[model samples]
Target: MAPPLLIFLIMIHGVCSQKENVIYSPSHICALKDSSVIMNCTYTYPTGHQITKVFWTKGPVKGVEPPDLSEDPEYSQRLQYLGDKQQNCTIRLSHVTLKDSHEYYFRFITDKPDVKWTGIPGVTLNVTDLQVESPERVTEGDSVRLTCKSSCTLTDRATFIWYRNSQPLTERRDRNNELLLQSVRREDAGRYSCAVHGHNHISPAVQLNVTYSPRNVSVLITGSGEIVSGDSVTLICSSDSNPPALNFSWFKGGTFVGSGRIYSISKISSDDSGEYKCRSINEHGEKYSDAVTLNIMYPPRNVSVSIIRSCQIWAGGSVTLICSSDSNPPALNFSWFKENESSAVGSGQSFSALQSGRFYCQAHNQHGSQRSDAVTVTVKGHLVILYISIGVVCGAAVIFMMLVWRIRRMKKRNDTHESQMVDSRPPHDRHKACDVELSDPVYENVTADQLDDCKSELDSSVYENLPHNNKRL
Candidate 1:
């Protein structure tokens, strides 16, 4: 019985000598910058026990004794008594800079004589500079990558935040901490930075130098073909770049010609014809475009003016005043000027003006421009009057001939009618004498003398022929 009782007493003594309970508010060491930071700890003791005193201390440095809350005068101003004997314990450091970086330990006591607790190898605080990384230049329609690396070894888990042009970006984990810009455009070309949030500490800014050249460069001419002298011509150069173009220059015949995107030649001439080039430059690099050539041909010549007539155009008849000029490569423009007003005409060799007056034409080609000598067109109004008079005279002659033909026809009809009338009239008494006349003539007045003559003639003949005819039986 005595041996058993002695063994129980030793067991009770072993239980009473066990260590007190303690737990830190924040189990991990936190980092901070030149700003505020919070540290906390919590613990649980036997139910009957109550807290009496509580304090905080710094871990032992080198071989020196750990800081004591009751005796240390140097830490008094900086130290805080945040622990509640009955509830919780936490510490806050304000205006914390690099110098405040150190391990913090806590100590506590309870009203029950057997209960006591102390912090179990507590946390360490580190203050560091903010992190900053920025890109210098970015081009339009390009993807950009920026990386933000920790200057110091970031032992704890940290969050990285990215920014572009001072605007906040999405936060991400420390690993794979690069900001990726998908299909970056000109608007994305600006300063970029990253912020590291770990243990409540932010790092300093870091700059990234990025560069790219112009893209999609193009050249355009306002008008194609040969540019005439004394005519303004424009050549336009365009490109896609960030921060806009720094400089634009034009070259002709391998020599710098102008200082703007649109190079204008106030008076284009044959001398202006050459291989023209344009170059655009930015902070990134220089870009050159393909060259174009201008061809200047011969000036206009053989300027002649005339009037166009249709049929027998009399005075007051409308006619066209024509001016023509010959030029190589054809004329680019033809203008008709009347009075003080000028209007552009067709590009053909001739131009016409309907309203005749003092008029002329000017022709232009790539080489030069020419103006014809002015001519005055005199329109005769009396010719129309003469034509009308001649027409009237000819019409009268035709009418006179027609009247004579009608009169002759009427006379012939009248003569035919009279002849018919005379033929139709009855024959008179001449016809009655025919039968009686024949009866009266039969009674002879053949008288005696005629008989005597007949006898005598017969007698002579008888005497002569007496012998011949004796018998007259």
Candidate 2:
């Protein structure tokens, strides 16, 4: 009984000494997703006990069998046993996933199964991912900043690497954790991410948007060259920008006319002929396109004919008729036509009449033509015969007047002084042609042939509004 008691005392002393020797530091640990981590583990045994094998397990070896972490298929490629017989049981895990979040222990076998030991309250690993923090949207020409963050501090000495659209960005001035972008452009908009220099963990990509004002603005027309009046016309304004332009305005002759990217002028007229442009605007700024000139085509308008004669409209006498019109091309041609005639009588800006007829003129351009109102011309034939006829009529009227005057004088002589008319007349009536002796206007010695000249002068002035003088032959 005394020998047994001494052996029990030795065993008790050995158990207490070994308990103080075994060690596993930092009994708790957390790691980032897909990141490598170091598990600080160590163990010390009595000098006499030889350690033949060392392995790590999920937990304490309760009954018998325990597997090694390095041999497991799930951890074979990623687990590294960086420990040795010197009592260092440290381990390195690469590309750790969430499945690795289990309590772990260290075991030792010195040619005895019972010598195995494990540390309780193992590291608690939480697989968290890195996140990229930045502004979701920014205007062009503005500065931007980006950051890489994790749920917990991975390491104070962690160096960061940035990526744009899955391509490595190596033009960094400083090897810091933040990325600075100055005066960002539209081409700089894309997905961005960051990661530690050598760590497998990377932040999730974040999309970046760059808003910019309109650029490369221009105006487009559906057709080129002359646009005829009363024809449909279309004008379009277009531009490129990061954020699409929301407002479009159209201007003509420096005056606001309409709104929209498309400006349509239906049944275009001559008034629409002018300089036109468009303006594109967005949240950032606005841009204007170069002015474009619009040309409207039209036919001759406000057409009329001029009779350039100061005398009467006569067949024997030469008279000139002029055609005038308003047109864009200045009326390419002019034509003279007689009244009630389908075909033109003459072609040119002016025409001379040698016969009695009704005439009109037309001015023509590329688009169309216009005709003026008609004017009539009359002429006297056989001048000597016209003069003889006028003389006979005047002689008869004069004889009749002489006879009546003789009869009236005889009657007055036969009457006494009291019976006489007394020549009593209103003073106003005495001025009449019949009361006083007057010249006979009917026989002015102007024949019909001469009257033709006077009639022509009147016709020229009255119908054509032509300039003329009242000259009589």
Candidate 3:
């Protein structure tokens, strides 16, 4: 047996030697995938022992020498050593992936036989991937929350940033892993992603869909709202909403007129003139546009003239005439014109006629003018009885004259016939008259003279049967 002092000194040397083989390193580390990672380490050994080989190995077992990471096909290309064999055992790994997650050990071999050291409980590397977590859909105006998630806890303190549609949301930087939106609007909806402030690793984007009702509902007229009759008009209903509104209803005043996004009026008339509006509807909700007026204009029509006082005149008197028409924007101007005259006889809706003539009325408006058929008006004196008396007298006088002339003509014709008969009485009748006169010769002197007297009397009687005027000729 050795002395106590020697025994104590030998025990002390063994303790010191055992303590010198220790390796120092972090117990745990978290790193991003597809990125570089560094494992910091240091080691101590006995002063006389010189290291012959230094390398890294993973998942080492007791009583067995593990193969170097550089020798492994999976890690050979990415594993690198950055420290000397004396103390530093730092290593760098390039293009790390989640499959590389494992506990690594730093191993060194001394020049002496059966002399080696391996770090126990070495750095535990955690390879993690980032992902964005969000709800699939949300209604507009509702609060929303999105999170930047990871498969493992990050070793570094991170500041979360958000992105929408590949564009960074500059004001959405948050210390927490979550992004909060109060009363989210439609503009806030898009594909979202997150990242640490200083790291290039960004989470995969998540789509955030937002549903909303119609807004800013309005009707657009293709042209001027004011139109003429028989013209076409178009109105389009427009609104802002998600899943655009497909159903639309049109209204004229309080009545439902049509259905569609576009309301069309072909050959529009005055009856179509009114306040119109449109209702836009969808699965979400509906909205109504403010009313708009569609004005339809037309020319004057159905113009007419009426004699308010007298339609016909018998004597000299004035008559009142009224003009009227049916038209949009009622005819404001009126004119009365006499037939066969180029100028207007009067101007107004009413006219007084003082002369005998046919008159017409014309109604005028901005659109057009129309004329009414002429009406007859007369002015005459009241001398009808006196004129009738004079005509009767003249007619009687003419009848009397014609009767007298007819009588004279008949008397003259009778006389001519009697004279002709006497001549045709033959010579015998005439000789007998002469013989009678001769045989009565004894009475002759007186008789022959008396015959001459009688003959003269007969001639005078014929003249008397003729008209006095004929006797004068």
Candidate 4:
């Protein structure tokens, strides 16, 4: 037992005389305000003594006998020791502040009253309250810089890490503390933060606002393609930007029409047809939208009523009155009007001419209506024409009668000439010629009394020339 004690004593004495090595990665840390932090530490001691206690010390009253974090008023509920006395000594502090920034050391005690050690050159905690230093507003295409700041100067050199919208950004190693934006745009806007490289605890995110001019501007219109005169319409202006647009303006062709994000026309007209655009303005800059076209339709114009073929119409005769007009929707409804009449005389594209005088027409549609200029419609007289027509017909009848008489006389003369030619021809020899007569049987039909009267007029030479059988009769 005495030899064992001696050996133990020698080992203890050797371990006590040797210095312990303290290992703590990232000697310097940049922590954000009101964020959780971890101080990681581990140590080695000679192989003989039982460890009793381990604790941390930092901040305002740091050098003398320091207070235990477990008992401190500010850190009692928000601090946790995650390590044991053997070799590991790490702690977690929640909701850290600028006051937490200081030099920190880890000290350990053993069973022997005299065997106590504190690791010098311990982990250096640099609680840097990161702040984004940048201009409040900036215009698009403008160059800008954002700086990351710390509450206290750190003894150890550190590399800065930048985050946007809680996500880490890619940048060259040379740009560690500041972020340079060559041309600020609407996409380059979000919350920003900074932290030290190789440190898990980051600074409280400070918002980085990149102001920019309006872009991708356009005008939104709501109206029908058949937007007629007197119809209502609305126009909206839109743009992409950082922050809100300050003002809006509207233009029609070269004329300044109105202002505001929404432009309204209570009653549109034909004059409203033109090229239109919108202008957007902000603290950053101004931008214009692409041009759009606005068209206002109307019912009809230049309506008129005219007589088909001729303006003159005979009494008791018929004529067509045609209505015409120029209209956008092609004048679906038409009406004919007479002078000095309130109501329409007829309702159609054409009307039959009755008692004609002065007439007009109206063309109408859903949009509006138009009336035509009056035109005179006169009824022609037909008394002289009727008389001339009767006289001409009588003359033609007389001429036709005379032509008939002449034709009859010519036919009679031809018959008489044929008869004379037969009688005057030299008689053929009696022996060779046979007599032939073609006539009505007047003698045969006569009674005795008629025969006696006709007997005196009869020619006896006709009987004398008869054949021998009738010679004496």
Candidate 5:
């Protein structure tokens, strides 16, 4: 007996001195449907402690477990024994689903701890239902709120997060473990989901469906409220929508006027005047705006012509003729025309009248056309009259010169005639003129000196009669 006691004590001491074999694996797993998953667990004991039995068991409904070798009927087929007698205690599960998801308890029986068991921490398996929800719609300038609820019961304090079209939103506390939004905008409208984290597991997401009416619907005018004939005008309709989808239509005088986002009047006329309205439609509903009136005024009103200057203008004098009218958008074209001419003068509102004529102006716009009351431009002919008067004065001056020359010639002739008359009278006084002469005339020599003169004359006469005349007498 003493020898047997010593052997037992040695055996116990040896057993206690040997190190235990230990194994460890993951105690929790998360997977998706139709996917594979691994459950990790390990055990510890002496080197010769062969792993006799290794199997997984699901939790009993609420709480009961049998202590004997009889297997629980519910986990018979799904349970897998992964560890062999020597090593490897991890398990792998295939074709996972929500129904197969639960807490699994790993039980291992070793040869050294006969009839006893080594169990690791139970692992909770989570099978997620990953799916996307349909997108939502929201109008411009309106407010919306979306909520994402979880399909699982999250008892532990969990963090809830939201996503828009796959982008993560700010995390939220787990009061209800739901994603929430306040005053959502058009840009916030899109695919949304919620993620819940609790009990070291994530719950499946819940989708939020949001729909709203169109907002900020408005109509814009390209021009003023008053339009004219032959003028171009544009009316634009705009609004905000979810999915960026919208239909725009225009109406005039309670009747459908045009299609598309903009309604254009190529040639606006007086007949185009009426009340205009715009309507925006979406999947949510339709919205109509208040009507705006379009009063097409006469092309131009009160067309009149004004003469800027009327002084005695020279041939090159500049005179301005102004054509004026009242119209919206100003008159595009202003032209001056002679009463019966085929061409237009001056391409603008005012024209310089260089030539003399009767001129009129025309003011035109898209609404209509107007002709100014005819204006008569009487270019003064004073210059021509002045030229004529200067010619007449020059002709008068030439006639006066000719008359004075004729009078001077007559005066010279009269003086010559008077001198000849005086000469004819001088003949009676010719004897007196001879007495005054310095020399005697030949007829005055007959007065002799005495009778001797006569005797001598006789003797001379006798001598003269004889050939030589006797000088001796």
Candidate 6:
């Protein structure tokens, strides 16, 4: 309802006073690390006002002149102005880092004194680096997931690539940021990292630990193949596990013998010869190793000769004697010998004694040899009986001759004594005493010479008395 002239005047005044001094563009930007970003902007001002200075400043404070980004040491080399000072205020920030993230404002100064302007609610830049999030530990055979994280969502559509132990996983690529592992195994444990495809930035690595039970358990013997008795031996238990097995148990056959990573037998004996195994244990589980035989070589022992008695085995004046011994890798070679002979008379485990004598057997093995105690073998035959009879007759004859010689020597000594005494009444007395002495025998100690002379006389008398064919006996 106002007048036309007043309305025209108000319109002219409004048109003259109206000034659009503002910036138009996106107010927020999300950028990748070490990459370039563009800030599209435009500005306006009242007519007849020329821009004297134009620059970009970050984190502007109220009533304070914001520091120009182009002059800043951190951004000077990377900042570039791409638009004119009048309208376009676009800018490019190259090689942006996390430290470059801040609110930025486009500022301009007019030629007139006290005339300056700054865009309010300016562009907010957010620079982000990749990071990986994973579990600290995972049991084997369990599914696992890892995520690639950033402070802000990336502006570009990205495909994630995974890596383990610094090696790229060529088969694992997905549009999502998560890496899924199905029924994970121990081999999958390592330093894990993630990256966006077509981007140079990669996340820092994180360690992934996988736990499992023992596997490939085995026992190793530290020595040569020839394990002789009295030699020291060691058995080592080894296995593969997520965490190294700290407990180990040793078994001899089915009996538990010891517990340790290394089992040592000092001065091992024959009793130690058997199958040995080891068990490797950890928190996860345990596993047993394959059994290994400890063949302890030793010398022959407990050697003995036994006479085999059998009704049908006795043959032709000979008896079978068997030699037995105890040894590892049983003694195969045996030698038979007489009691007093230095050389072996026969060879083998058994021996036949044709003649009566004391016999023994020697058992031989790689380690050493041993001989058995001597055993007496007696043979019964016609020749043996005849020899026994001869021996008896000869022994009796020698004793009878010795008695007669002693009696005669005593009679001679009595005769000499009677002759030496002057026989006055002595002859009749001596003759009477001699007859009494002959009836009762006188005893005395005989010298070696006397015994020798008696033996000589007895031999002659026995030979003459025996039959001519048996004289040699």
Best by TM-score: 6
Give the alpha-carbon lDDT of every model: 0.61, 0.73, 0.79, 0.71, 0.60, 0.82
TM-score of each: 0.48, 0.59, 0.60, 0.56, 0.42, 0.69
Tens-digit lDDT track of model 5 for 355-424:
6888988899876678888888765567657767878999999996786576556546644764565467
Worst 10 residues of 2 by lDDT: 464-473
Question: Which digits, one per residue and each the tens of the lDDT, describe model 1 over residues 1-473?
Answer: 34777755544332212334455545555454545566776655667766677777776566664556435655456556566775567766666666666777666677876565555566667756555544555555567677766434444555677766666765434455577777776555556666665334444444443445777777788886656656788889998765468699988867887887888777776667789888999877788888887775568887766777764355444556666777667776777666465565434545444444677777777766788887775556676688788889999999967865765565466447645654565533222221222124331222222223224334454434333222221
The candidate 4 region of ten consecutive residues with least summed lDDT is: 430-439
Error of 5 at 10 (Å): 36
Candidate scoring better on TM-score of 1 and 4: 4
**TM-score for candidate 4:** 0.56
Q: lDDT tens string, model 2, 1-473?
A: 34777755544333224332445566556677887878887777766677887877785466767788889899889989998976798888888887787778676777555565544445555565778899999998899998887766653357788889988788862466688899999989999988877777667899999888899899999986778999899999999986889799999978999999999999999899999999999878899999998878899998887777745333235677888888887886988888988998899988887677999888888899888888876544554455677788999989967865765565355334313332466544533422222123422332334334235334343423312221332
- Strongest candidate by lDDT: 6
> Model 2 residue 231 lDDT?
89
**Candidate 2 lDDT:** 0.73
* TM-score attained by model 6: 0.69
Model 5, runs deviating above 4 Å: 1-96, 99-159, 173-176, 182-188, 196-214, 220-234, 241-266, 270-321, 325-357, 362-473
lDDT of 4 by residue, 410-465 (tens): 54664466456556666452212213321223222222332232244346764344
Ranked by lDDT from best down, the candidates are 6, 3, 2, 4, 1, 5
The worst-scoring run of ten residues by lDDT in candidate 1 lies at 429-438
Q: Rank the candidates by TM-score, best first.
A: 6, 3, 2, 4, 1, 5
Which stretches of candidate 1 lie above 4 Å from their native place?
1-28, 34-79, 84-90, 105-122, 128-161, 170-178, 183-186, 195-238, 242-305, 309-389, 419-473
